[model samples]
Target: MVPAAVLALASLLPVQSSAAQNHAQPDQPAKALARSILQQLIEINTTDSAGSVSATSKAMEQRLLDGGFAKEDIFLGGPTDRKQNLVVRYRGTGQKKPVLFLCHEDVVEARREDWTTDPFRLIEKDGYFYGRGTQDMKDNDAILVTAFLLLKKEGYRPDRDLILALTADEEGGSSNGVDWLLKTHRSLIGDPAFVINPDGGGVDLQNGRAISVDMDATEKLYADFQLRTTNPGGHSSLPVPDNAIYHLADALERLQHYTFPAELNAVTRAYFEKLSTIEHGQRAEDIRAILKPSPDALAIARLSAVSPEWNSILHTTCVATRLLAGHANNALPQTAQANVNCRILPGHSREETRQALIRIVADAAVSVRYVDDAGNVHDTAPESKGFPPPPLTPEVIAPLEKLAATMWPGAPVIPTMATGASDSVYTEALGMPSYGISGIALETNDVRAHGKDERLPVSSYYRGLQFYYEYVKMLSGGQ
Candidate 1:
């Protein structure tokens, strides 16, 4: 449920924002509303730092209600005031599968000491909005809500219904938000033809180029593994050669030494081939040759020659992120544990990764246990052909691709794989084809997502608002 504080305050504001809505033209009013609402939301501490989400949910709910959504169409069902999920619906003509535009509301804690301005408040400087969740991704939320509200006010009945979910705890697991919704409120999210999450996109090849549309048809599944070694608890005064610390360290070292086999499936192959076409000079030739079957040696040579970030995309990676051992400085500790986060590429399973780890460690002294099994695994013959790639139905992709061509020509539209996860995982798991499209036209240098002083380019955010309107119209028209 929404927090009393937010609801009480919302009850006092004008129930209908028609006064502000009437000030702008119908075509541009949605974008204006998006900007206005985003500025208001930036004022709230939506971060879970306070361990409560009622305030944020209420603010969001009120914003939607005032924007034109019916009160019953908005929902708030979750644990308590600390974490509440928001769902708002817009009516449409019953002609196509309803489209679901998903995003999260909760943001990671921003370090005030590290930021130039208060991260909680919107700081407009030099045309950009400096605030947390601007890119990762309050901008998308604002644009989406604006699109729905304006469509409702204009009485534009879409061919398909529009369902909007502003989930909680996306930075954490989905246990509180999407996961619960899918399980408990399945009917609310009708069997969608597909979903569009505005989290994944490609860097522009150059300035003023069409932002490469990186449609993530596939993503790496994460499996967390814990490595532990036990030794007798003894005084620090009496040191042993094979103590828990040393054993755990050796296991980590071994893990570092061994690398999971790099397997390029159809998606990666298609991705690189497209990259090969637009990329210039030597890089293009090397990339093109790597797409050929039996190009392992050539691919490895080329990948290793490039940056580590690029290398990771060509392979499965494992990194030890958390280490746990002794509690007291004086104690040597009887047990030591390390948490290894592994990102397994497509065509592999958690079990296969586990077995690979066992081979790497090759030590009986250290035991491996999985913390969370995120995906199911199945064994298939290495030579057997797998399912064909997801069909790019023109009905869903044409407008998006056209926009890309218009915005960025000859930019090599590639079907890329997301190294990180997104809310699309839920829709994809539900058997609906999903696309992650963010209209933000960004270069490769921008990096503040889940980092210090996150900011969004003013042009990109505004353009995204336009993109949403165009996309909704195209899909609803079946163009």
Candidate 2:
């Protein structure tokens, strides 16, 4: 009962054999190298733990040395003792400024018991390689390293010096990683024409399909502040006008009620305008209205209600995460504190956000302060040698998108604005246009990132190998 056109299309497709499916190699040597590197990485417990990076760095250093990278070029960057950073450089012909590939070797803590397999051991089942750092970053690091080593092995030189930085402690802040490296090793990344941090930006959603070609040109700001209040302590039996907890609750209520002004920036405007053309009906009209210079509140309201993913694109959002104050069950607490985190659109300053928060609380008793001060704003540079994402070029994205299309036909390329942050923050802070690009392919609805049983399909690992090999070759001005 299949339609004639469908049958005809199926007939035209080349039959893929079982062996081809099982042992499919996209650039066999590169695939083997990337997979091998990843397995070694997963084996090391490189969290913020005591001995994490030492072992991991040693393994990576040995690998680089075996590939013939100069021992001096593989020195560590960070505090002398614990897990530190790793840097590798590949010399190229002096035709252009070098393209710096930024990567972080640290990962978030993973609970051993919560996982179906040993999170530190790379487990392959039904074509998926499951491990702790599979998605959030190891996949990115693996490809870049493989590409660097391959170029070296082939004796191919790039137009500019290729600098590869793998830093530590990104799961926390750059305290131990890029922060230290940038401050101490400025000469290493200083002369680069532009840089690419694969930590932000992604494909955009179009119609019911995702446009896989879009890349994040910018990222929202991150601000974490505390809402604190103090009041007179008394016995539980005595009534008070407003207790610490009560004041905090009232402030939370007001914050939840008030919505920040929604202003679509240039990047988001371009994003939606492109999507509207590909979508249909109300969805299309809604997108069109949202992109207008002066979008109506109704349009904003509708879009915000659609998804947190979409709401983030339009307005700044605040959420109360932690609370502390009460001491004993029967005793009245003297002070109470609530933690509020906000993700503001790019170009919004942390100071502006802090002031807005003060106004929102509007309570005489409460005082506010920030928890992490990693500078919540991106410092954009003009006349940089690249496109909208200055340091990250259209040159790089073009090839990456082409790779994605070739690897997964029918998968749309949608430029994305990531809600979460990554080590790319360090590169961005250095005024390098950084992005979070990877070679993994996921179904439209799969959510494997930073989750238990985290995994990447075996095909994705191999495809990434090929893409990076091609990418490095092109960037280096090679064949």
Candidate 3:
């Protein structure tokens, strides 16, 4: 729950629309270009298996080269030859530091058998664009590329250098695109004012109407813990009381009843404060109550139980994602393991959660260990004591609020912390403040990112294109 004093910083004023006046509606040619780039990206198999990120990187590199970008300003390489990243610089007048527009080109694997339509092909049906990367992020990749091309064609020079990075392996792989870039090619992406990641923030829609524009300033840390219990093997016909499978089951049951204490930070505090105004009935009341100096504990509990998203936002969440038992069904289980995936609260340490899990399990025989392929236990970010999240500076917030008001009047712009992780963590760790401000809006209930039949609304796609085009211009001092 949030504190009432935090609401004092909330600003509901609309920003003057000077950039909007300067920008014109996206014409047919621009629309066609955006669609073409999006379709090309979606059709290229960028999945982990049976797909090569190098192919997509090469294609995008060619597009920039053909668009009059200097060969030196463009870079396409990665730790591995197969997993490549593309970094392009749109030089400005050097009046201010560079601003990075970052997005991942790799997408979650989508099988043909799992989707009703070809997941790799961009298809427009029922007022929606159905595809794998439509929502999880090729949409933003296309929009950013389209904006870059349009800006170049129109001769709209920015006040500062604008860097566009389309990286690989955000979904899951040994060669993470952003990590590789930071380690190998840090100079390619210069020190920036801040990063605007379209992968994070968006408008939340309900009943086809805009509710709020969520601007993600921070995200939870992702960590996986392996819980294992081992015992001597025996024949199944002579079952023993001290069985590995039974001990593992007991630990899991205890974990199911355990819940981390609800914690709040600046981003989450402001989130609940603004959301309280829009939500109705008891939920709204509970939200408001939680913001008070003396918050109602019962109300917090009630709200936490209502939705999984709500629970995650309020607390550090751990759930068993995978399980393994005996080698053979006929033999007593010699070993059992469970993969407990946890999305830790920002500024919290993975070791703290690991300790908590061990304490909760309360079994000396059960071993809890952080699972990392590299075996580097120190890879997790150290925990900070208080709410040490990145601030929502006026430079970033003003434009976003103004744009949200311009696009969907009356909708409040709220800063949020993502329960899921993103590549932004890498940049933030490198001392550049990163934000998720993707202009694409989606229905909150129907978000199919990383799921089967992922899609985005047709109207939303075009709106996002226009929003980003103007927003980038504004950020670059166009008005």
TM-score of each: 0.85, 0.85, 0.91
Off by over 4 Å in 2: 1-24, 27-29, 49-51, 174-176, 201-211, 237-241, 373-393, 409-414
lDDT of 3 at 231: 91
Candidate number with greatest TM-score: 3
Which scores better on TM-score, 2 or 3?
3
Residue lDDT tens for model 1, 430-454: 6777766766655445657888878
The TM-score of predicted model 1 comes to 0.85
Ten-residue stretch with the least lDDT total in model 3: 1-10
- In order, what lDDT does every prediction score? 0.69, 0.68, 0.83
List ranges where model 1 is wrong by over 4 Å.
Answer: 1-32, 48-51, 202-211, 280-282, 373-389
- Residue range 104-141, candidate 2, lDDT tens digits: 77777788899989989999998788998887678777
Highest lDDT model number: 3
User: What would the per-residue lDDT of candidate 3 be over residues 326-374, giving only the tens digit for each residue?
Assistant: 9998999999989888898877777888888999999988888887523
Model 3 earns a TM-score of 0.91
Clash count for each candidate, listed in order shown? 3, 22, 0
